[model samples]
Target: MGWFSNAPTANRIQNTNTIAACVALLEANGQVLNEVNTFASNQINRGQQLSAQAFSVQGAGSQLGRELQAAIGSLGALKTNTSQQLDELGQLCHNMELLIQQFDVPRGARTINASGRDIARVAVHDTSLVLANLLVLEQNSRPDIVRSVQTIDRADTVLNQGNANQAGLNLPGMNFRFQ
Candidate 1:
């Protein structure tokens, strides 16, 4: 009968320990989520920069392509290389988004202890905020990649057309031999 009296105390101690462990886990998860988000965002920024460079090259090639058709061939190859890299970057962003989704942030909305619950809430809130920012970065950067691909494709088309047109013309300085 005396041992039975200590049962409630033991259960309370166990519950408190469980809550503390949960709080620690949530805090650690929040930190990891932040690190992952930062990495993903940085990769996205780099992808955007690469996309811009591709655009610049495409612009210059487009302007110069009218005069020197041979330059278009080399510039078009460069454009292809950059566009492929952008596609890989986009895939990486997608994988990062999926990885972030797998992290199960604990919800403490119904916990009875106000202070522990508040800590859990803040951790969960912070992780969610970081996730949102990552999602925004991903969404925004994806469009740039798409647009870059489209532009590069258009440039390729123009370059091909120019090459075809040049094939039939016999410019004074350039010799045309078709096999």
Candidate 2:
């Protein structure tokens, strides 16, 4: 039922599969970080625009302008720290993937790795887009939440296919390093 459930050869193949999963995880995390950055930038821009409007209409010395300025200042401080933390996380995930790739992998355990990753990557892309769009829906702007839901459904389908593949779908002509 599992890669490590068999023997040493299976262990090696499992390690290779683990590395593939690590790559997907790292890629997903990177996309998330990029979305965070976009969110922060859009938020800062919105705050600035709001502040400008308040100042122009209420006068630069007005109480509304003063309050908006303070809020924007706080957001600025938070963005600096938030972006730095996200960068560190991205670097750590990248390094982890690299480390995992250094391990040797036995043949015949590699099955549809790229296909699985493609499925996961589509899900990740849609997820980030949904999050970012939700954050900045804008004036009377609407995003189709259903699309994200459908992507999640596709991910579920991919998961089921992966389970079936792992269960007993061994290829006949290939040499399996692990029995």
Candidate 3:
């Protein structure tokens, strides 16, 4: 077959199939990122509430309270960063979706001059770039999630200790309970 020889319909179908597969994978990744974002937001909110409770105690300026405050602050920052990462992932997926929609399968005489290979090449490149960025997002965000969880655990422990210490003080005009 010559350079412009008749390419089989199977070639175009395979190329379109590859592009479709990449789009599906990227869309799935976007969804997972969204779920992670929601979880991080909830964790951040709880951390902030824990910080407030920590400061309400008489020993608000103590080491434990200070640690809780720091952890809560980090969680807020983590949420912000994770949101940005998720947005990037969403955009990548959206672009792939558009590309896949425009991708066409050559039929009949058009197969002789098919550009499916070129389109598939571009799709593959886009997929690779998205995959690399997704890896980075996963690697970086994992540490933040782990750290946030650990901080929450520590804050919970401190709150438990503080509440136990002040269990039955029955101070006048002051009623605070950490749950």
Candidate 4:
């Protein structure tokens, strides 16, 4: 005969389900974090491009020149926001990972009581919330960057027009173009 009753089996099943759910949540969070990181990198690259263009047209005091400056400023703002959001996401991920590790600790017996079940339930809930928040942050940050980039492009277009008109006057282009 088995040393324990069917209660142990039930507890084992519950524990298994809890662990599975937590692992799934963690994996989803990981994917979102990766996407956020990729988006942040692209934002940085775009910011750098805007900065370089601004520097190229630094001396020319025209509407297009001012537009270029504004574009650079917007990009700087986006970078700052993205960096802050990423830091928060990283911290959340770290905390979730630690919680999962704690759940994975070996138990003395298979008879999971109410306390163990409660802990597992709480961990699962926390992980889900973290994942949700991460997704929301990523979605919000993306659109902000997109809007900023669009503005920058519009400014660049106006600046390019100025560059074309000033071709004969030897005014600097928005960027250094070796002709």
Candidate whose lDDT is highest: 3
Instruction: List residue ranges in candidate 1 displaced over 4 A.
Output: 1-8, 60-179
TM-score against truth, every candidate: 0.32, 0.46, 0.71, 0.55
Rank by TM-score, descending?
A: 3, 4, 2, 1
lDDT of 3 by residue, 74-114 (tens): 66675676577667757767766655544532233343343
Q: List the residue pairs that clash in candidate 3.
A: none
How far is each candidate from the true structure, as Cα RMSD in Å?
A: 17.8, 19.6, 11.3, 11.1
Instruction: Output the better candidate (1/4) by lDDT.
Output: 4
Instruction: Please give the clash total of every predicted structure, in order.
Output: 0, 0, 0, 0
- lDDT at 113, model 3: 42
lDDT of 1 by residue, 79-153 (tens): 444344344444444533433332212223222323333433443454444445434444444444344334444
TM-score of 4: 0.55
For 1-179, candidate 2 gives per-residue lDDT tens digits of 23223345554455556555545654555465455445445545654555566667667685655554555555455456446645654665565443443232212243323332333354345434433433343211111222222322333334344532121122111111110
Which residue runs does candidate 3 get wrong by more than 4 Å? 1-8, 105-114, 161-179
Count steric clashes of candidate 1.
Answer: 0
